[model samples]
Target: MTVPVADDWRPRLSPGLVLRHDRARETDVLLMPERIVVLHGQASTVLELCDGTRTVPDIVAVLAARFPRAPVGDDVGVFLERTRKEGWTR
Candidate 1:
């Protein structure tokens, strides 16, 4: 069953998955078995905070502080939910 991502959910990279920066590409990539998901925009920033500690609100707060005018709450929430559904995060 698919579980909806909650506001209190603490996200982290799934097992066996690694996030790294590809020097040649100059961007962050999610490394998994036989697959490389290239990250874009603030994706790397968002994923870095997914250390299995901070809740969704905390993540939003951090981003909001960095980009005070941006709608980080909704953006972060949607991004997290999508990543969760994609099995990249837990």
Candidate 2:
């Protein structure tokens, strides 16, 4: 993953993929062409916000609002970089 400077629109969930939260199963799932990704914790929250409309910095802002005490910007930025590299997001 390339290092981002917060201003770049680095990643969003791939358009072909589908993200769903199964309440009964208590899981966050990403459905791909050949496999499914079961996300947890921060991954779940981050992916839930990756609707192609939010940039990395925008995501960080949203998460920060939800988690006021945590240092969400850096962490979310790093997670987004990984997700972008992983091909789960574009």
Candidate 3:
């Protein structure tokens, strides 16, 4: 799968953490260091896939099934980079 990553950073899920979202309330799954990372629709979908067990590509593949419109390749690279840089995942 592709991560739809951008930027130059990569993110990982902290061992003690899990992504939990409240769609009805619009709450987001936030990572440490950074707080209140409100996921916006598809971005949330991507972040949810950052389980650390999967590689960047794995995320993209999973997401591709849902968001066929997402940009692949470099696009995923950018997303990974930005998320990591923000210190969101791990």
Best by lDDT: 1
Ranked by TM-score, the better of candidates 1 and 3 is 1
In model 1, the Cα lDDT at residue 33 comes to: 96
Off by over 4 Å in 3: 1-11, 15-18, 22-34
C-alpha TM-scores of all predictions:
0.92, 0.81, 0.63
lDDT of 3 by residue, 1-90 (tens): 444443323357655555677576667756444454556656766776776667776766777777777665556667666766655566
Candidate 2 clash pair list:
none
Specify the highest-TM-score model's number.
Answer: 1
| Model 1: how far residue 73 lies from native, Å | 1.1
- What are the lDDT figures for the candidates, one per model? 0.90, 0.79, 0.62
Q: Sorted by TM-score, highest first, which candidate order results?
A: 1, 2, 3
Tens-place lDDT digits, model 2, residues 5-85: 457685677877888887767888888888888887778888888877887888889999999998886688777778878
Span of ten consecutive residues with least summed lDDT in model 2: 1-10
